[model samples]
Target: MKLDEYLGVIIFTFEHMKDIPVHQLKDRANPAGFEIKYFSPGSMRKEMELLGDDVDDHYLGAHRDDHYLFFLLEKGNASLMIDFQTLPFGKNSLYYVLPGQVHHSIKNEIVYGWFIAVDTMLISTDYRNVFETQLKLQQPHLLDDKQLQQCKSILSLLLEKYDSDVKSSFYIPVVHSLLQSFIGMVACYYSQVNNTGMQLSRPLQLSQQFKQLLGRHIRTIKSPSAYAGMLNVSESYLNEALKKATGFSVSYWIAQEVVMEAKRLLYYSELNVKQIAHHLGYEDHTYFSRLFKKTANETPLEFRAQNRK
Candidate 1:
């Protein structure tokens, strides 16, 4: 099934649960623009029950979402797997999952949380860079009591506006403003906890821009010098700036991006190894397999067989 259909199944199951009501900014008949969803603990549990024999069993396998997800666990404990990294979270913790990320619940013990799913378009490009690039190296934020309370207050207000009976014209603006504030707060905390201060130097800014561009053109542009040219900077200058800011050369980052995309396509797409290689701009399937093994410590087919659910 297509990714959207899988997401529909998950959403449809949640919509039928006892106390969880999925709120959408747009009407189903004319779905357009970014959509937002809020899920309470009761709804989450009910949806898990709808999916499998037990709540824990239901979410213990890998799955990918087509939208961004922010999960705030107010109480209890759970282990989450995102892109092969196992992240353990407990009360007062927040986890961000980007679109197309391979993730799943590894374990849960009476977990109680709130989940907000936002359409990618709804999130500003600045916030996306913060989330996808800057925050990728960090772990989940375990907020202090004060911070937790502040987040709860924002979430409560957001839900209130979301469920309000006000007219669309009024409600939309209010909720939109609140949503941006909420996301901004999260980004601030993420930056704080990750030790990457909010301010960006010129080199760091260029590094971020380069990463974004590489994400867009990774399959076609495999040369760091080409990326440097595209960014209108000399290759040596680009390398120096990137190394100073990110502790890695541009080539290392490019190779990492390629391997990451290869892993995603291998796990989520039905294309075979050769087809996957060709799709990723490799002419030789054997060379692609060798590169995948060198980067990921496993062959493409082995990785796929082990990861695909």
Candidate 2:
């Protein structure tokens, strides 16, 4: 299939996957992190079967998207046999996968879970704005039976409201809110079980709240100080908190993340430079192009043409 055609199919499957009387959630990336569309597993068996080939149900291939795979395993604990050829399985293991992480599911294990795709949008605040233990999940981690039950409850609530036709408009926001809430719950559990005490850090809490707000308002606001003012904190305090939590300057992180969004639009979207610049909140295309080059080491036109070629 052609690229656009395939994307169309994936997009379609993603949007209506919940309406199909299956229990699955499939989402596409606007950039690399946003779950533009998703549905429950019960509403997506056929697509799962078809995509099982692309994703290969028992295979080791990586997801093409740059989002983390948040699987809430809800069944028998099967072993994942992986490696150069084949490897032995580990018992009673639950799985979480970040983008670019390597691993695969076990074959014929009949594992049940919810898969989520997160969109990488502009980050108007510092990268250090959040402190959930799950956010620090640099690698795949395991969830236990209790955590799995919590996740199932979250999904069940989502499917209950989202699957119905009378409340279609509220579906998207409800799902998005629930995903965030679910993450918050998982983060809380990770913090409690692990006794990490990382979530209680004042700086981390402020930083994460800022990050969530930034995700929601990336298009309009792009300044660290602006976020600080909005969040009722001084710019210096905000910057210090973020720096203490994430090790980078707030301004640098914001600019870099915003640039990442620009790259996504320029590469995956057909928007012109001016349009892309406007989409990213810049009035001048020249400035946006310059920022793009500064961050990515290539002019917008050159970057798009070379990569999209």
Give the winner by lDDT.
1
lDDT tens per residue, model 2, 1-309: 111111113332222222111111234342222332233334445654564444323322212334344444454343332211222222223333433323333443443445444442321122212222332333234666676667777867765654456445656666667767766665454455545554358776766777656655777887888999988999999889888877866676667667656665554456788988888799988987888888778898998788555
Worst 10 residues of 2 by lDDT: 1-10
Tens digit of per-residue lDDT, candidate 1, span 17-131: 3221223323321122333344434544555456665333333344555667787888887776666677888789887877656665556666556666677777887687577
**Which regions of candidate 1 deviate over 4 angstroms?**
1-66, 166-169, 195-198, 268-270, 305-309
Angstrom error of the Cα, residue 155, model 2: value is 8.3
Candidate 1 total steric clashes? 0
Q: What TM-score would every model get versus the actual structure? A: 0.79, 0.51
- lDDT score, candidate 2: 0.51
Candidate 1, TM-score vs. the true structure?
0.79
Error of 2 at 34 (Å): 18
